[model samples]
Target: MCDAGLKLPPNNEKLQREEEEVMHGANLTLKLNFPQYQSEVEELSVKSSTEVGYVKLLIGQRKGITAKNIRIFYNGTQMIDPMSLCDHLGVSPPSIDVDVYINLEHTIDV
Candidate 1:
């Protein structure tokens, strides 16, 4: 390996591009309309697996229902679980903070 006598050029442009990519994640809009759950949630942080669990538990408390029925949507994709969802979307699970939708079925209009 080269010592202090030699150094490689830094890639400032590459680093900047990476940072911009990280901030380019999409936002989701959840529409939770369960009458029993009067709690309002404009955003939910989901950055990790634990955060996913936290969201699931939080939903249970607010909606008085289990997490099984909870499904998240972003763009045209359906987030069914924490791992697959986060990995596929390249988004920190916790960074997902948009209006949380409840009791609304996802559909595509003609």
Candidate 2:
């Protein structure tokens, strides 16, 4: 219990490191192509179990935009399920490429 009467979780660095190491093993390298933005391409590494919405969040952070404005596509099909895992969407194995499209109104050249 802390001074505020709230129980704090254990700050075990070793446990956190172990968990990170485990997750690292499942990381997938993805090639992101921005066809709507000068045909720009970027590589990103994420966990295989990562959700589509989280991918948008990651890209949004780098592009200074919100996740809601980003759209991800695979195999010429738009990934509509934000909660779907990347691997399940067939965007895994590190060889598949993902297409990212941003709304023209909110597009930022980056």
RMSD of each: 9.8, 8.1
lDDT of 2 by residue, 1-110 (tens): 55777686689997786687466535677789999877699998877667788889899999888888898888988876545445454555545688898886866555
Give one digit per residue, the lDDT tens place, for model 1 in 1-110. Answer: 75669676687987775565466433333343333346644444333433344565677666666665465555545555544334545444335443344544422223
Assess candidate 2 and give its TM-score to the true structure: 0.66
Each candidate's clash count: 13, 0
In candidate 1, position 34 carries an lDDT of: 34
Any idea how many clashes model 2 has?
A: 0
lDDT of 1 at 60: 60
* TM-score, candidate number 1: 0.40
Top candidate when judged by lDDT against the true structure: 2
- The Cα error of candidate 2 at residue 93, in Å, is 1.9
Candidate models: Cα lDDT each: 0.48, 0.76
* Superposition error at 106 for model 1 (Å): 17
Best by TM-score: 2
